[model samples]
Target: MTDKIRGSIGPDGPPWPVDLLADLHAGVLEPNRAADVRARVGDDPEARAVLAALDAVRTDLGALRDAPAPPMPDHLAARLDAALAEEARRAFGGAPSRPRPPRPAGRR
Candidate 1:
C-alpha cells in the first residue's frame, strides 16, 4: 500500500496495527481492543472509512458462509507464518537497548 493508503497514526501514537484492524473487521477483537478501535475510528475519518469498507466486504461475503471455508495447506501456512515473523522482526528490531528510567535532577 502507498504511504497515503497505508496505516496512519491518529493523534495518539503509531497507527492501529493491521492485526487489530483484521480482528476488528472480523468481530473478534478483545473488548478493550474493540473499544480502542471504536474510539480511534470515531476520532479519524480515514479509519472510519476503512472500517466501513471492511463491513461492506463482510456483508458481501455473508452468503459464502453456506460452505465452510477451505483449510490452508500446511506448507503454505508455514511459509506465510515465516514471512510475517520476518516482517515483524524487521519492523521491531532487537529490543530498545538503552535504559529509559528518569534520572534524578542533574545526573547524566
Candidate 2:
C-alpha cells in the first residue's frame, strides 16, 4: 500500500511512531518545558491557534508537574520509600542513589 493509503501522513510529513511520541511526551514533561513550548506561540493566526491549544495542554501538564510532591498521608512516603529501597537493593545490591546531572547553561 502507498504511504498515504497506509495512514502515514503527518503535519510535517510522515507519521511518527509510538515510541517517538512517548519520548517526546517524556521530554515535554521536564521542568520549564511549558515555557519553552509557550515561546513557540507565534505571530500567524493559525499558528497562534495551535499554540493556544498547546498552551492548554501545557497548563494541564504544568498542574500535574506542580501537584504536591510531598509525602502522602498514612505514612505512604515511608512505605513507598521502603518498597523502593527493597527493590533497589534487590536490583542493584545496595541503596540506589543516582546523581542528578547538572542542567545546561543558557540552553533553555
Predictions in order: lDDT: 0.62, 0.48
> What overall lDDT, based on C-alpha atoms, would model 2 receive against the true structure?
0.48
Pairs of residues clashing in candidate 1: none
Error of 1 at 94 (Å): 59
Task: List where candidate 1 sits over 4 angstroms from the true fold.
Answer: 1-14, 64-108
Q: After superposition, how far is residue 43 of candidate 2 from its true place, in Å?
A: 12
lDDT of 1 by residue, 1-108 (tens): 223444554424345544456677777977887877777667656556767888888877886877776666655665666677677667989743432344344333
User: How well is each residue in 16-99 modelled by candidate 2, as lDDT tens digits?
Assistant: 223323333446544564344334333335445544555688889899998966435444545666677778878889656553
Q: How well does candidate 1 match the true structure in TM-score terms?
A: 0.43
C-alpha RMSD of candidate 2: 13.8
lDDT of 1 at 70: 68
